[model samples]
Target: MADYDLEALSLGELKKMQKDVAKAIATFEDRQKAEARAKVEAFARDLGYSLPELFGTETKSTRAPAAAKYRHPENPSLTWSGRGRKPQWFVEALAAGKTASDLAIS
Candidate 1:
């Protein structure tokens, strides 16, 4: 490992060095993760299971799409799963003094 006299470096040099260090760290982390994953997969195979069989593969739609947890008051078609970002209709309804419970599909 080469020693760096960071204190002696100019602002531009320091910035460049910082960028280089970040790239190196990212590469090192990626390599480490790949190695760890390989080891785990190998162990799983030895135990008579593939990696996905051991860890479980991510399904495109996990356990069926989340049922609509919230629905628009005027439009039943406009619904939300209450998972990700609030929909525009949901936000507008809130702004219009509608509580989340008021929009429940049930």
Candidate 2:
């Protein structure tokens, strides 16, 4: 790894580097999980069995993504799953006195 001259770098450059580092850290976990899963699958295959066969098909790792539960009133393309922090539009809708039911997908 190259040594960074943090004091000599501009604010924008430092911010960009911070963002890049954050992204790399996030992806590293995913890469590790994928590598471990691959190794386990390979081991299972050597024993004439698949990972799914040993761990069932409905494992949390293979679960489907949450379906969107609400959409923007003006833009149908923008949606929310009603999970985690609400989207900007969803928050604005609530501030404007629109209930969750008002924005719900029908």
How many steric overlaps are in each model, in order? 0, 0
Clashing residue pairs found in predicted model 1: none
Give lDDT tens digits, candidate 2, residues 1-106: 9998899999999999999999999999999999999999999999999987998885456668899999999999999998899899999999999999999999
Candidate 1 stretches greater than 4 Å from native = 60-106
Write down the worst ten-residue block by lDDT for model 1.
Answer: 54-63
lDDT of 2: 0.94
Clashing pairs in 2: none
TM-score of each: 0.53, 0.55
Q: What is candidate 1's lDDT per residue for 41-64, written digit by digit as tens?
A: 889889999977866885665577
> Highest lDDT: which candidate?
2
Q: Cα lDDT of model 1 overall?
A: 0.90
Off by over 4 Å in 2: 59-106
- Which window of ten consecutive residues has the lowest lDDT sum in model 2? 55-64
**In angstroms, how far off is 24's CA in candidate 1?**
2.1
